[model samples]
Every structure is written in structure tokens, then in C-alpha cells.
Target: MYAPQEDTELLAGALVEEPVPPGADVLDVGTGSGALAVTAARRGSRVTAVDVSWRAVCATRLNALRAGVPVRVRQGNLFDPVRGRSFDLILANPPYVPAPDGRGRPRGAARAWDAGGDGRLVLDRICREAPALLRPGGVVLLVQSALSGPEQTLGRLRTAGMKAAVTRRRRIAFGPVLRDREVWLRERGLLPAADNEEELVVVRAELPV
Candidate 1:
């Protein structure tokens, strides 16, 4: 319904620092409001943007028009429409909030933030699937909450044959969703008994030519 939050901004900040070559081919997974897609286009990279939500696709299209940046927008699960294609750079700010089991992949407001307990449902798949879509010497900039286990993301990307690391991290007070789930998050050992902040991390995974 709206653009993403601090996590998205943090990833955008981190991405602005990467060395994207001129005319680089870039993919923005979960393009949402097309913020990062616009950024990539503005930086002179050819951009392709994707999201599973119809609203997000429309938002991305509108945002791109407003920004005067051309973005190839598609509605599909992560990487599906782009299968068999590789890119010089990829960006994602996926859902990483830990939620209860049996809560199937959401389709409404919660779809933008809710992931299964442990918060790796989408993250793990990204680690497993993204490396294959990177051209040599390419990179994927992924952002997630530390509660989802950045180490796990790092390890999985490395195992998938990419060098991955946390390049940026910031802690912020719980948003409304997290605040609402505080009790369950605490019970699941995700949030500390006395802690009210969550850390967001940008994971940079790269392939060597």
C-alpha cells in the first residue's frame, strides 16, 4: 500500500555506494514502490523490477512514470519472470518479520512484512536462488532483519558460491507490526525480554569474474 521503511532506505544507502558499471543490467526484486528501481535507472543502469503484489506492480509503474525513469515491471514471485536471465546487479528488500506457523504466505497488508517464524522463509530462498542469477563479477544487495539470522544468509550465499557479508546494519524501535507481535516474538526467543529494538542488515553477496 505504501513504500517500505528504514530497512529499504538502508539498502538504498548501501547500494548507492556499490560500483555499478555504466550500462549495467540491474534487477530489483520486490520492486515495491520502485524506489530502488528508480535509483538504479537514475544511476544509468538498465533496470528490471518485479513484485508479487498487484498493488506493488502498479505502484512501481506509477512511481517510475513520476520519476521519469524507465523500468521493466513484472508481477511474479521473486525471480520467476526473470528465470534464465542473469544480471550485473540485483536488489531486494524482502519481508523478514518473524511470524507464527500455519500463517501461510500472506496476500494483504501483512504480505509486505510477515515471514514465517525465524524470518527466513523468503531470505533463505533468495540466498539459494539469487547467486544463480548473477553474471560474473555481479552483485546482489539484500536487506533483512538480523533476527532472521544474517549469519545464516551469509553462510547460505557462500555455500551457493558467492562471497557474502553484512555491509550495513541499523537498529530501530519495533514498528507497529513487530510491536503487535512482541509477545510472540519474545516467546520465540527472537526478541530479548528487555529489548524493544530490531537490527536491520544489508547483505552484499558478490560473484567474481
Candidate 2:
């Protein structure tokens, strides 16, 4: 299972700035460590978190338990587990690394960051589907790597008729995964040869009420 990292904390920090009504419905997609779900529940919102990995699902439940917050955890891809349900808030920190191949499905821990060649495998899908899963006036806050194309994400969400913008950004040195893929990323023109840091961004999109 993926542990909470910089992107996780960045997304959670942005979540704190959002005005969540008491008992508001919240969905956390790709909830790795259940941190976001637990945070939402602690704010008195009803939370449901979904992960494609069974291990992640178990981890979320365990973390929620330790945090003394109630979180409904489910194992499924993206929106499958919450079909027909609309929520006041949706949170996501999906895999957005630009993999060398980016064709086949990623396995094991790689699932936490491997995306297609352009790093939008899961990001694009979230943009397309999140709008439908959001209640009118609800918001979806997603964190992604700058290399994965945050502008593309913003444009996609805007095209979906939602108000979308980048709310927060941070630059951090390359982590293990990115470090390992640096050569490939540079060759693909996704990373600068001289740069060792990447910009992480929280893109927030709101549905019209």
C-alpha cells in the first residue's frame, strides 16, 4: 500500500481550506493510506474511500480505526464502488508518473504512480468522471505532478463545464521513483536535464450548483 507522502499532505491541506458542511457526503478515490478520508470524517462529513488495491483498502480501514474516525472503505477502480452516488466532495491522489511504456496495467506498489507515457492515465479519467459523481456545487480536489500536465487537467475539467483552477503548488526534490525514472523522463522531454525538483499541484474543480 502507498503511504501518505508530500502529495497526500498537499491534498489534505487543500481539503482543510474547503468548507465542508456537517454530514456532507465525501468520496476519496484511490485512497492509499485513508488519511484524506479520516480527515474528512473528523470534520463530521460522511466519508467513503475507494482503492483499486485490496491492501490499500485494508490500510485505509486500519488507519481510520487508529484515528478513531468512521470511514467506509471499498476496493474498486475509481468510481466503480460509488456508482449512482453523488458527493459534496471528492478527493484524489492518483498515479501520474510518466512511465517508460505506460501501456499495460501497473502492478504492486507501482500502481501508486505509474501512468501512461504522458502521465494522464488515471488523471484524465478522473477529470471525465468526477463531474458526474459530484453533487451540484460540490468539488473535487486532485493532486498531480507538474510533469503529468496540470494544465491539461485544468483544461479538461473546464471543458466538462466545471470551474477548475490550481489552488496550491510546491516544488520538491525527486523522490525515489522519480529519481529512478529521471533518465527516461529526460529522454522523453518530460523533465529538464538540469532540474532535480518537480512541482506538485492541487487542482480544484467545482460543479455548478
Candidate 3:
């Protein structure tokens, strides 16, 4: 089975080093395999992980148990399951793949990987809704792709009235999504004649008091 990737691990480690107040409540949006939620719980945060996929929710629960941490895993879209709920910290590794057609997402798509066209569908919603779900002085951690550009994500957060910054970044090898595309393009003679490397952009943004 396809499992949680290294970017998830990197995002978890980044959250561990951030200033999370003791016993802070944390929400892990799009907790695909629950890696980040488990890490936050193990670090003493009260964590709730939300995913739209039943499989993801189950995976998160099992992963949390394996990690010996208690995390509430919920199944719902975005913040729907936790409406009226606010948290001290929110972490999300949302789907941000920009589709080639330049159109919106299709129905019943993979919530963890498909980001619709321009790869900003999920990121955009998170930015717009996060402020309403965050406590004063809360912080949000987001890990997306450079395909959508770092500034674009930051701009959304700023427009949402949150102070945002890029705290950490590391180049990651292109995963299956990009790999398949590269193969298709090569077969069609559309790929560049030279070597190419794809990278992911992991960013952390905070909401000020």
C-alpha cells in the first residue's frame, strides 16, 4: 500500500520544534496517515486529526495507537467535522497538485493527493477557513508544493489576517504524481531534453494575537 511519505515526517519534526504551549490543542487537517497527528500527541499536545477519507481516518487511528498516543480521528471535509471548534495549533499537509487542465477538482477525487487545477484548491480553503478555527495567537503549519509557489500560499494567509512565514524548506524527489506525468510527457516527446528535478515546499505560518 502507498504509505505516508518523508515530507510528512519532516513536517512532524518541524512542528515538534515550534513553540507549542503546554497542553495546547492541535488540529491536523488532512491527516492522511496520521504521522503528524501522532507526533503531536506524543509531544503532549491534545490532537484531533480530520480527514475526508474513511481509509485515512482508520489509518490515522491505527497509526496513533502504534505510536502510543491518543488522537481523535474524524472523517469529514476540511473543518466541517470540527465546526465551532478552535485550536491553539493547526497542521495540514493538504493536496496541492495543480491539474494540467486548468479546471477545478472532479467529484470524489483523492482528498490526499488531488489538488485540482493550479494545486491551490486545498491550500486556498485552509487559508480562508483557518482563522475562524484558530485561537488568538494560534499558529498553523502548512506543507505544500513549490508548484503553487511559496509566495502564493503566504499571500493567502496574509489576506486571511494571519502573519505568515516560511520556516523550513527541503528539496524532495518527485513522488509518483510527478513521476507519472514525467513518463507521459517523455513518451509524447514533450519533456525537456535535459534532466529535471522536482521539489516540494514545506512552510509554517502563524496567526498573530
Candidate 4:
């Protein structure tokens, strides 16, 4: 639901540069709408897109067909469907909304967009498990928000034994998630009425060879 041009552009640029090299395997975790996976497939990577939502998985399949790219779309949580498999590159736009009480998400797409109590649940899991799924010299590209603590995400990657860096960042207008959270925070006096800025952070990390 928070799909944006910056997300698409970042994936496009990464694929254009062939970050995984030719004939490498790539994984698009949380491939909502299949944008990154499809783009990577078009660039000749053997791509697999994974999502927990059946609707998302179906949408990705339909989108791949429309794009004429043979991307493998799987319905599973995170890396569950591809256990024991490793990829040369991994890309993710995980749900990072901080839902302290787990009430911020709608029932249908909660798994797709909710990150548990602190909004870092999915991200933390990804960081913890990604190293095992990455091939030697493999890289992981993750996009998250400042609301989720950009520095903390980077730190998680480093703690997971990956060489991490913030590859790109941009000031994004308040979307629905942010707007809703702002309202909630405002009601509790946690956020001031004058603050309305949001930032998106894109991080790239490499698994050691």
C-alpha cells in the first residue's frame, strides 16, 4: 500500500547495474506487487519472490506474466519456502510500521505490513536469518523508514556479520501508515503537531565471502 517511485527506482537501478552479476540467483523477500523481483528477472537473474499473503503471491504471478518475465512466486513467510537455498542477492521492503500494540494493521494485510510490537520484528528476523541464505559475496538490499530507527537497522545487519551501509535515502511525504501513526502519537502527546517529515532509508549489505 505504501508503494512509491523511490522504491521502484532503487530496485531498477540496482538491477541495471547487475549487482548480483550474470546468471546469479536472487531473492525478493516480501515482494509486494512483485516490483523488485520482476525487475531483477528482466535483468536476467533467476529470481524468486516470496510473500506471506496469498493475494500478494497471486498478484506477483500475474504481474510477472504481464511483464513476460519468468519469476518464481512463492507463498510463504520470509525465507520459509526457500530453506537451505542461498541467493547471490537479496532485496526486501519489509513491513516496518511500529505497531506497539499490534493494533495498527488491518486483519487482511497485517502480516504483509505489520512488524509486530516495535515494527522491527520482521526486520530483525531478516537480519538474523539472511546471512545463512546468502551466498559468498552476496549482497542484501533493504529499504526501511526512519520511524523504524535507521541506525538500529544498520546495526542489526552489522551484528549479523554483514558489511552494511546506507546506500540511499530520501525525504518522503507522510503516507497512510505514517499519517495514522502521527495521529495516534499526537493523541498521546508523543508527537508534536508541527512535525511532519518522514525519511526513507535504503541500505545495502554484503555477506562475507
Candidate 5:
């Protein structure tokens, strides 16, 4: 399982900036390590965290317990475990690194980062499904490398009738994953040669009340 990294920290920072009402219903999608989920629960939101990996689900439950907060953890694909439920707030830090070639979803640890070409695999699905899970006046927060098209994410969420925008952005040196994929990323025109800095952006989409 992928550990908490730059994208995770960026999203967590955005969560701090968002105004979540006390005892709000919160859903955390792909809650790897449970960092964000625990924080939300600590802030008094009733939390449900979900991950596709059993390992991650287990980790989240353990972390929430250690944090002395109650978090309902589940194992399932994004949004599936919480079907028919609407949330006051939602958060995600999905895998979004662009894969090198036509390798249908890498089967190992790389599955946490190797998204299909254009890196829209999980991002697109999140944009499509998350809006429905949000209650009116509720917001969804997503963090991703700028390589995966934050503008496109904004467009997709806006099309779904939410006011969507990049709420937070951080430019940091490429991590090991990006450093390793630099050549292929350049070849795909996703990154420029000699450009070592990548921007991570937090997208916020809020439905009107």
C-alpha cells in the first residue's frame, strides 16, 4: 500500500481550511492509512472511511482507534460501500500517476499510482460518482498531481452542477514515483524536460443548497 505522501499532506491541509460543521456526516474515499479520516473524526464529524484494499481498510480502522475516534471503516471500491448514503462532506486522494503504456491496471504496489495514459482512470470515476454522494450544500475535496488535469476535473465537477475550483495548490519537487517516470511523462507531453517541480492541487466541488 502507498504511504502518506505529498498529495496526502496537501489534501489534509485543504481539509483544515474547509469549514466542516461539528457532527457532520463525512465520507472518506480511498482512505489509505486513515490519516485524513482520523483527523475528520477528531474534528467531530461522524466518519466513514473506505478503501478497496483490505490492508488499507484494516490500517484505517487501527489508526482511527489509536486516534481515539470512532470511524466506520469499510473495504470496497469508491462509493460502493456507502451506496444509498449521502454525506455532508467527502474527501479523496486517488491514484493518478500516468502509466507508461497499455498496461491494464498494474496488479501490484504500482496500482496505487499507475493510472492509465492521461491519468484519468480513477479521477474520472471520482468526478462522476462523488457528486451524487454529496448532500446539497455539501462539498467534495480531491487532491491530485497537476499532471492528471486539474482543470479537466474542475470542468467535470462543474458540469455535474457543482461549483468546482482548485482550492489549494502546492508545487514541490518530483517524488520518487514522478522522478522514475520523468522520461515517459516527458514523452507523453505531460511534463517538460528539466522541469523537476510538480504542482499538487486540491479540488473542491460544492453543491448548491
Candidate 6:
């Protein structure tokens, strides 16, 4: 399971700023450790956290219990376990790293990162499906590396008829994963040859009332 990192904290900060009404239905997609889910629960929202890894689901459940919060945790791919359901708010901190060629579908813990060549393997799907899961006036707060193309996410959400914009951004130095893939990323023009930092962005898209 993926642990909370800079991306997770960035998304969590955005969640804190959001106005969540008591009893609001909140979905924490790709919830690795249930951090965001618990945060919402603490605010009086009914939280449901989903993660593809069963381990992650268990961790979230345990964490919520330890925190004295109620979080309905599920194990499944994004939005699969909650099909036909809508939420007042959705949070995602998906895999946004651009993986090299010959890397097939991520297995085990690698699923937390290792997105496809352009790094939109999971991101594109979220853009297409998340809007449908959002109720009227609902919002989606997604954090991803700029290397994956934040503009692409913004365009896709707007195309889906949501009011979308980048609400937060941060420049963090390349972590071990990115540092190892530095050569490939530079070759793909996803990163600058001289730059050692990657910009993380939180995109907020809202369904109109």
C-alpha cells in the first residue's frame, strides 16, 4: 500500500479548505491509508474509502477505528465498488508517475504508482468517470504530478461539463521513484534536463447545481 506523501498531504490540505456539510456523503477514491476519509469523517461527513489493494482497505479500516471515526472502507478499483452511487465530494491521489516502456500493468505495491508512458493510465479514467459519480454541486479534488499533464485533466473535466481549475500547486524535488526514471522522463520531454523538481497540482472540478 502507498503511504501518505507530499501528494497526499497536498490533497488533504485542499480537503480541509473545502466546505463539507455535516452528514455529507464523501468518497475517498484510491484511499491508501484512509487519511482523507478519516478527515472527512471527523468533519461529520459520512465517509466511504475505496482502494484496489485489500491491504489498503484493511489499513484504512484500522486507522479509522483507531481514530474514533466511522469510515466504510471497500476494496476495488476506482469507483467499481461504489457503482451507481453519487457523492457530495470525491478525493483521489492516484498514480501519476510516468513509467518506462515494457512496464505492463502494475502488480502488487507498484500499483500505487507506475502509471503508463504518459502517466495518464489512471488519471484519464478518473476524469471520464468521476463526473458521473458526483452529485449536483458536488466536487472532485485530485492531486497529480504536473508531469502527467495537469492541463489534460483540466480539459477533460471541463469537457465533461464541470467547472474545473487548478486550485493548488507545489514544486517538490524528485523522489526516489522519479529520480530513478529521470533519464526516460527527460527523453519523453516530461521533465526538463536541468530541472530536479516536479510540480504537483490539485485540480478541483465541480458539478453544476
**TM-score attained by model 2:** 0.98
TM-score of each: 0.97, 0.98, 0.88, 0.89, 0.97, 0.99
In candidate 3, the residue pairs with backbone N, CA or C atoms under 3 Å apart (3 or more residues apart, or in different chains) clash, namely 98-119
Number of clashes in every candidate structure?
Answer: 0, 0, 1, 0, 0, 0
Ranking by lDDT: 6, 2, 5, 1, 3, 4
Residues 152-207, model 5: lDDT tens digits: 99999999999999888899988888889898899889997767899999999999
Error of 4 at 113 (Å): 2.4
* Superposition error at 100 for model 3 (Å): 2.4
Q: Return whichever of 1 and 4 wins on lDDT.
A: 1
- lDDT scores of the candidates, listed in order: 0.90, 0.94, 0.80, 0.79, 0.91, 0.95
Better of 2 and 4 by TM-score: 2
Better of 4 and 6 by lDDT: 6
Candidate 1 residue runs with Cα over 4 Å from true position: none
Please tell me which model should have the higher TM-score, number 3 or number 5.
5
**Cα lDDT tens digits for candidate 4, 114-166:** 67656688889888899899988999888876667778878988998989988
For model 2, the superposed segments whose C-alpha errors exceed 4 Å read none
Q: lDDT: which is higher, 5 or 6?
A: 6
lDDT by residue (1-209, candidate 6, tens digit) is: 98899999999999999998999999999999999999999999999999999999999999999999999999998999999999999999999999998989989888999899999999999999999999999999999999999999999999999999999999998899998989989999989877889999999999999
Candidate 5 worst ten-residue window by lDDT: 102-111
Q: Is candidate 1 or candidate 4 better by TM-score?
A: 1
Worst 10 residues of 6 by lDDT: 187-196
Tell me the deviation in Å of residue 48 in model 4: 0.7
Writing each residue's lDDT as its tens digit, candidate 2 over 108-182 gives: 889999998899999999999999988899999999999999999999999999999999999998899998989
